[model samples]
Target: MEEESGLSDVLPRDLASLFSDTYTEESHYQFCGQQLRITQLYGARLGVAAPVWDAALNLCSFFEEQKLNFKGKKIIELGAGTGIVGILLSLLGGDVTLTDLPHTLPQIEKNVSANILAGCPPNVCALSWGFDQVNFPQDYDFVIGADIVYLKETYDLLLCTLQHLCGPSTTMFLSSKMRAEHGTVDFFQHVLPKHFNVDLQWRNVEDNINIYKVTQFQN
Candidate 1:
């Protein structure tokens, strides 16, 4: 798995400190036979959307390991923090869109701009879960998310957004760091299965991350 030092171990003790002025950080990874330099903007008060998380790295690894073909696929990544997963997919020839909360777009856009290919540039957009999902089309070939199922408050909203984004044949791959306190497992085990057929695709035992392959349940 891709590893980064510093900030991952030491986070600010003060809650207010997390909302301070934004600083920049960079992470490097190998994907699709190319070294990717991903620029991450931190301390901008963009919770969960600033840095590249472990789950995101693991998801990228999962995609490469599975040898999934992304060429010509229309993909959308939800809660696309740092836009790493979508960017990697875009590199693999997928027509990708990276989406997150409005405030999160700048960092995502920066990363997308920094790593633009000649003709495979990924689009960045603001997607506020349930509220703005209607603006996006529902026929994406693949819906991808990493570490997005933590908040209990937004469970329903996230589900609603997933429903709006997925068409009949759309497949979803969601990677999550299984933090018990955050109710991640409950959302995957109980809530998600109701609307989608969920299957465990991969698991990183050491990091407690799991990747699930999901598709809409047919009646």
Candidate 2:
């Protein structure tokens, strides 16, 4: 499949074909039975070109259920592929910056627009990830990432990006699915202590589905 740049009514349908069997034109997620809308695909399941596997919705459920108050907070989401979490956070009352590689911006923007239930929330921009590569707004109360640790080499870049934007109160909330023989857990364990108070919120230790809730960011 070629990289797509704009939202076409048929684009989601086309993406559905590529990730067939794993994709659904419509999927619903429940945030305390409030019934949030989501599309699920093995990759971009929502017919939306977003790269989120159901993990993004799971993250949203966690925050919503926990009653996270992002009110008047500066927030950022790294690897915001579909922009779902970032958009939802904005709706939950935070100022949000949604960033990903430039190419994925269109899908994210489309998803953000499409999934907004009542009216649109403000979203800042789509950017590439690099330390100080972009200007920081300062005083980040929280940062988030979902299923972003897909490569070992990207580890350092991810941490550097986190350090670049976060202020003292920042909490990095991450959700990931562990793939066999993948070093994501090792990567998290290695760096969590350097910047956060790490704890396993839930780990399907048998199936490799893991959720980590991190807080108290240092430096």
Candidate 3:
């Protein structure tokens, strides 16, 4: 995707549309203790018309702490809504693949390009996810998603997607406000241990979020 030309192209207007009323271009959120560029795009209008909420950004503090040399390692991000997290990984040097349902691909592409306004880096495009086949790189080093679990029916497909990408060395990181919804904790408990070694790092009840590290192998 091409880098979007202007800052006006990426800014958000409404508070409710942004998931949290607090994040703005001037907001300083310290994650992992680094002052990093962060964008919150949930419900931020994107696309040919307006954007939909299917993804969000990575806290660069936490992201920078992650030692992924994107130089050649294969990385695939599931449910990449705004595509921020995946793009950041790509920017850091990974051979990145961004995947989301077909409906969200366009905005994902748009934001990918928009974020690259600072610079256009090369990376793979969007793909529709499937459970039956592990179609991309078989030896994936990392797989990640943010705020993806909120439904029961999607549990089967989400697990299928994660399993297809895991190969004994893959690491998975999922972040979420873990907002009140159907089957929230059940989804985490059922799928977390079965697919990857789960680590509950921290929880910010005030922010309604949690941090987890699920890896393919203990390091």
Clashes of each: 0, 3, 8
TM-score of each: 0.90, 0.74, 0.67
Candidate 3 regions exceeding 4 Å error are: 1-55, 65-71, 117-133, 217-219
| Candidate 1 lDDT over residue span 144-212, tens digit each | 999887666777888999989889989999999886766789989988888889999999999999999
Q: Which sequence of candidate numbers ranks them by TM-score, best first?
A: 1, 2, 3
Arrange candidates by lDDT, descending.
Answer: 1, 2, 3
- Those runs of model 2 whose alpha carbons end farther than 4 Å from true positions after fitting are 1-26, 32-49, 117-120, 131-133, 204-207, 216-219
Please report the candidate that would top lDDT against the real structure: 1
lDDT of 1: 0.82
Estimate the TM-score for candidate 1. Answer: 0.90
In candidate 2, where is summed lDDT lowest over 10 consecutive residues? Answer: 1-10
Give the alpha carbon lDDT tens digit for every residue of 86-187 in model 2.
Answer: 877777667787776666666566666666657546574654456443476657788877777655556676766666776567777887766534566676
Best by TM-score: 1
Instruction: Report every candidate's CA lDDT.
Output: 0.82, 0.63, 0.56
State the TM-score for model 3. 0.67
